[model samples]
Target: MDLDLKGSKVAVTGGSRGIGKSIATLFAAEGCDVSICARGPETIEKTRAEIESHGVKSFGTALQGRDGEAVRTWTRDTCDAFGGLDVLVCSLSAGGGTNDERYWYRSFEIDLMSATRAVEEAYPHLKSSENAAILVVSSMAAAETFVSPMAYNSMKAALITWSKQLAEQFAPKGIRVNCLEPGPTMFPGSNWEMIKVARSRTYSGVLRQQPTRRMAEAEEIARSAVFLCSPAARWVTGATLRVDGGYTKGVQF
Candidate 1:
């Protein structure tokens, strides 16, 4: 089916690697002009090249997600460069850490504020689009208790709430908002990869709970995201999807 995504403009925070990169690339493959913002220029440029390989225009910006001004600036630049914005994916995250006080601040800034800032900056641009959609990348950890209590888990849960509220507020303007809660995903250079090597017990504990006895790949999560963010899923706003390969046990009504 045609996603009706050709020629659309998309911006993805943290699109240099992992799920964000997969989402951006998939959008490009569907013929969307993609813009990515991440922390490292080297990775951003390389990923930008990969996105352009799909035969769509790609832009890259290097900046820390915690910097609200930088995030807003990137949003504006992306809209300006692409002529307008139709899709925005907030997929950057400050990974989970011990319940240190500082981790709270870090998660609050990068995990939560980054999405808020980008949405605020992109609101008008999205309002002007015929097919505007936003996907907030939370975690399955937010829907169910998976690890020790940490700021990452709570902050992600907050995103689910915020996305739902935004969906209600933005629907009248033709802007779609939805949240995706990905389960423990593994990929090259992922935090889970590092945890697998350094924290085997915790990693094993998580795998034991996954029905498939394996983690979901980033692209697998991105597939759902791309569909939800595309015009194909025009009526799918205000929904929170837990694409975890059944890792999360809680039933959603």
Candidate 2:
């Protein structure tokens, strides 16, 4: 089915690999002009090539996704390349791990503030579009932490709150906003070491908790994100959609 996203200009963060790459690919396939950003030059180029292969106008850049100034600069460059931004997908976030207070601050910068900056930078452009939308990619941990990383849990929870307030503020400006909470998705180059640790912590239990009995694919999460940002979900805003495999319900009992 048509997502009605043709000619839309989109900006995606952390788009070099994993879920970000998946989202960029899906958006390109839907005929959107997509620009992606990540820290690694090699991965950025690779993902850019992949998306451009779909016959969509695509660009990718390597930059620090957490820095506010950097995010603004990247957004300006991307907007210039894409003409204008109609869909903003904040997909950048720090992965598993814990360090000292310095690390905690870094996580906040990368996970929470980065998303805020992206939205802030894209706001004007989004406001210009007739059916503008912003899809903030969060995690199930925002609602149900379970065995997720502590820093991730904290930042994502905050992200949900921020998205709600932003939604309320932007809806009146013709810009819709929503959050997407993706379950554990299996993606290439994923940090398997962390997954191994989580799995070994409670293998059978975690597996059983997921109704699907397996982790999600990157495309699965991307599909939900694309839907939330499309005109199909025009009325969806100031809300969070959980794309988990029923793990949330399983955790209740």
The top-ranked prediction according to TM-score is: 1
Predicted structure 2: lDDT: 0.83
Give the lDDT of residue 234 in candidate 2.
91
Q: Please, what is the TM-score per model?
A: 0.99, 0.93
By summed lDDT, the worst window of 10 consecutive residues in model 1 runs over 140-149
Clash pairs (backbone) in predicted model 2:
none
Model 2 / residue 130 / CA error / Å: 1.0
Per-residue lDDT of candidate 1, residues 184-222 (tens digit): 999999999999999999999999998999999989999
Q: What is the Cα-based TM-score of model 2?
A: 0.93
Worst 10 residues of 2 by lDDT: 191-200
Off by over 4 Å in 1: none
